[model samples]
Target chain A: MQTEQITETQKENKKQSTWRTAVSALLIFIAVPATIYLGWKFADRQHYIVSLLIILYSMVPFFLMYEKRKPQARELVVIAVMCAIAVVSRAAFIWAPHFKPMTAIVMITGIAFGATAGFLTGAVSGFVSNFIFGQGVWTPWQMFAAGIAGFLAGILMHKGILKKKRLHLCIFGGLTVMLIVGPLLDTSALFTMASGISWESARLIYLSGLPVNAIHATATVLTLFFFSKPMLEKLDRIKLKYGMMGD
Target chain B: MDDAFSGYHPAVNFIFFIGAIVFGMFFTHSAFLCASVFTSMLYYLLLMGRKGIKLLCTMLMLFFALSFINPLLNTQGDTVLFTYIGERPFTLEALMYGFVTGGMFVSVLLWFACYNCIMTSDKFIYLFGWCIPTISLLLSMVLRMVPNFKVKIMTIAGARKCVGKAPVNGDKKEKLQNSMDMLSVLTSWALEGAVVTADSMRSRGYGSGKQSNFSIYRPSVRDMAAGIIMLFCIVLTIICAALGGMEVAYFPVFILPEANIITILGVIGYTAFLLLPSIIHIWEEATWNILRSRI
Candidate 1:
């Protein structure tokens, strides 16, 4: 009878997990594209609104998945701690514009905890830091860029393509910031501040962002080179001591 | 000084800002842009006082820079003001478009500055907590942790200083290394403390059932009145915009909308909405002065 009950509970858990998987897939594959299509169709000229909606929609699946998991308090605390570190580090380095260890710390969180935790750390850091730096139209874009960086870091680490070594992590961090986060933010500048969406204006925006992106990328690479090992070890120690955030 | 507008319900504050920012972003008509930039500057000044002047000057610089750059990049207009290198003709239409765009961007920035002052974090959490409990809880936790970590880091640095190991003075690379060491130490301390915090939270039955949120905000009759007025203005302006009353064209030629009744009403609505907070503050100041004099 005990064995039967255990199997029954397992079956129920399996069903719930499958349902969640389906819902997340639907949100990502169907809802996101539908939103982009409709937003483009109706709000052709309103680039800011359209892009903002697309970002908000794309983020829904991650939040939904996280909420559905019913994460433990320890898990939440770990994510919060990562976010706080990112924000604090950004604040600590305020004198050096574009040279923030925030992205590097966020990537470490991803490499240590997992993708979801990493994303949350990045997004929350982007948001809370804006409280100090002053929120603007760039807030959402910054959040999205950082979150994606964390997400990619988590995925690559999980796939073994991104090793924990200093050289590997530094290269990954530099490339991610320059290729992904930088362009995403520059795109926001184009959509929000630029008058028109011509190729010329877009090129100008991207070119203007290059110097800032280079500085940011250098910061990330330096941070990862010096800090990733000890930070990862510390995170591993916490997980081992508390036996939490293993998943 | 306390802002009278901020005393309203959080929803009212959020609605007003959303309206102001959205309209400011979407509208490109020169009249509407002028109203937006002017009112946003006024409200920002009211919110920030003299400290805002420096930022306003920076914003003006940004506005001029953006306005100047736009004509150089976009050479699509008919009226050529001048030709630069590579036969790139700078057009008057592009310059005007640039000015309108720059005005919109600056106004949005100013409105956001005012919003940062008015809508504090607790209010933001209160407004969204019920609908998104998990995210809101996470947001609050992160916000709580940021300051906590800052204090902890300072303490750690102080402790390090007592040991003569603080990163106070060094060459650039050495300073970077010292800071990184400090960060690593802080991370370990923070992570260890976090486990205790999580355990304490768990002991308090945090995830046992649906969590309850507490807030001090309660909408009153005055808030209701403010909400109604804001909604009426927003709806009127949106309707006017939908009816093509706020239409503007910039490419190839510049065309401003005719001064029709609907367009005028839309502009008035837009201006009134943007000016609401400043008006409330000014009125409150006057009333306070009168009451003080009587007293």
Candidate 2:
């Protein structure tokens, strides 16, 4: 049965490969130059193009997770739930300015599910939570920031960097999430929302973000330290019993 | 409340959102940025009344703090304001740049709140549905799921409070345990609902074949007209930007571009775009008031 399922998925993948290659070629040869031309035509069009590209490129992973895997209904539901949980966890810590549990949740989702699932969780949560926090030009930046953390987490898990040792995971998760959310998000703000300041002044803001980034890192570590083990164990058992994706 | 802007086709609202966000962030000219800020404040007051004013005050405080911090850390410009430590010069250029940057930030931030008021989730789903249906389905579900999770958590907390296990009334350790218990309960509850959703979706043939979109928004003649107006405004704004009519160079020295006729025309077009919803709102309110008084 497993072999049959694998073959079916492989056939589906083969069928789509032609169009996939065509789309990528179009992006490379035509779409990219066109975007650049439009960007050069305007004064501050580069940031919008860059952000729109991140989301559009993220489609590769989105396809890998859904179309390639042909994830079962149950797995899709689980991924969506993980996204909801991550968003609510961020709100759960709303009183704390820089302490964000959503990063830890994204890390756990990536570690437990896979990188694709992790990226989706982070991106979805970032996008959804802005409804409460208010959506702006920074919404895409937040999505990219959180999504990178999850994508990195998946790489860590695949490479056995996340194996057994909880301390290593905490340290790595803290630093990566903070770096992405702090410096990256800060710079995006400078470029997209507040480019009146010089690049040097922008760098100053990034440097000053260190303290808050440290707090964010600490929150990731503490949340994961307390909660990740049980969640991972549960996910493992679910995979074993139900043959879920990433099993 | 049934707002006037929300009554438009979702595409129209989305176009306006794109216009406002792009134009608000794109132009760095002091007059343009100030106009954006002023319009944002006006819309915010119309949207959230006193709460919006409070946010405006907060943004002002942040602006001054950022301005002060900029000259202290970044001594890059020519016109020195004051010197800190031994040699670092607080330049007038840096200060003005900081002020303008702060204005840009506040304007974008207020526009976001304004977006929240105008572009409801239904509107968002309607916008994305045609292009990426599955993703929009997931997004709309997520929109529903977030508020549902909050309400469910509150219910769980209320139930726990009755049992003397609520996080609110307990000592340190107990409160910690209660919060954990609440999280775990929420996790389980979510998992249960997810499974049910999965089954229902499967039974209903979620991924069977190409499915048509179920959109509640339709493009009226008014939407078409409004779309053309927005497109014209955007084209005008872009031409103005490309012509360097809205230039405000602040690197070596703070400078405001000359507000010539072309720049003034661009400003009018852009202001009209940003305040389109507000205009619709005022028109609706005035007509309603007139009708009521006649009655």
Candidate 3:
């Protein structure tokens, strides 16, 4: 609220001018993957903590640089509410193990709100829900995995791709969950359990974890394909009617 | 809600969890991990009674699944069990590591469950509220709001049922439309509440005042003494653990830990640290029972 000028830049970034879009793409495809490989190659003895913290901390600068204005109080509440909804969405599907609304809710938050909001929602949901499900060494890994997906959703929104059609949104959401989230989780499982970690073992971990990952991906697509348009429309209307989110 | 440690200092709860969760994650000692899991479950049972059996069942599933999965993914180790669906040999070492890791995860989860009871959302905010005011406040709000939101959604779902518009019972298309309507209702309701909350917070000078907090927990002499003991025990355990006496090797070969004077001392220290809550609960329960009998 104190600073009003920054919002213009952030909204512009949302449209994702060429350089900014390139930077966003680099963040996912290059920066993150390189960090993972480095953490794996260097911190072999304690890569569990090392890699997780590296990925988590990498998120901070993006949040700082991307913010055009300080998030308004109401905007902060929106983010928190989105996070609460994401976690609560998990509870609704408790009977079914891998079927969850979390990833879809997160991506929608990004597409509707912005990158920072989406990332925060994902990271917070990962953490606070872990408190409900129980926290463990896997917490940081989950936090980053979810946050990255939301960040990419922001990029998707900026490129005008997510809103292009409902089908594209569902496709992007499903692929991100299936490819990124699953592999990140499986790698963490490998690092925690395996004595000597290697690329082959990482691949096998992915292979073995394929069954659960598929279910998770399918669940993501099902929720997004069905729910995203309606949810985003509601969120947009709320933003307009309440004069919240500086929309 | 039989809160055994309700009156205890928050620091005691904080220190105990740091010890349990950190040690549970850190040391690979089978004895210590088992102790962490066992005592945490026992503590849960003591505090929450039969409500804990379901949690125990979940923990058991996690434990077994982990043990089974690890051997399949991992192809290391000298002694190999039967091969998997393919050429991947199921190694005993991998299985052992999985067992230990699963134990660690369960132990951490149980300790956190106890933590959610001991250090409630209010108490947790109290502990860190002043330091990280913003994040702590948000966390407290989310924690409180999530369960409340669930109830409200359930009520909305029920109300929809009366109108023959239940999300659950509708055809796929109708269900989607019905659920979206309820979701919109929820968002609007939440925003109205948020506005009121922001107003209330502003009225309290939330941003302007030098906030002074009032806490009911006064650390008694008993708390101080227990805190000192816990500190000493943690230090001793760390020293022993650093000396390479607490855990066995689980890779390339599953070598059992050597049992000697140092390892035994380490085990005792580890046991004591993990058992802090359970021992306190038993002591409290016994004393309370005695007091009731005398009365």
Best of the candidates, DockQ: 1
Tens-digit lDDT track for model 1 on A177-205?
A: 99999999999999988888989889988
The superposed Cα distance between candidate 1 and the true structure at residue B43, in angstroms, equals: 0.9
Q: Model 1, range B1-295, lDDT digits (tens) per residue?
A: 5999999999999999988987787787888889999999999998889999999999999999989988987888899988989898999998998898789889999999999999999999999886557778989988888888888878877887786666664677776777788888778888888889889999998976557786999999999999999999999898888787877778879888569999999999989998999999999989999999997
- Model 2 chain A: weakest 10-residue lDDT segment is A59-68
**Per-model CA lDDT versus the true structure:** 0.85, 0.74, 0.73
Identify the runs in model 1 with alpha carbons over 4 angstroms from their true place. Answer: A1-45, A91-98
- Writing each residue's lDDT as its tens digit, candidate 3 over A48-127 gives 54555566556645544433233455676677788888887754443346667788888888888877777777887887
How is the predicted docking of candidate 2 categorized under the CAPRI scheme? acceptable
Instruction: Give the DockQ (C-alpha) for candidate 2.
Output: 0.40
Specify the poorest-scoring 10-residue window by lDDT in model 3 chain B.
Answer: B205-214
TM per candidate comes to: 0.92, 0.85, 0.78
Using lDDT as the measure, the top candidate is 1
Q: Of 1 and 2, which scores higher on lDDT?
A: 1
The DockQ-based CAPRI class assigned to model 3 is: incorrect
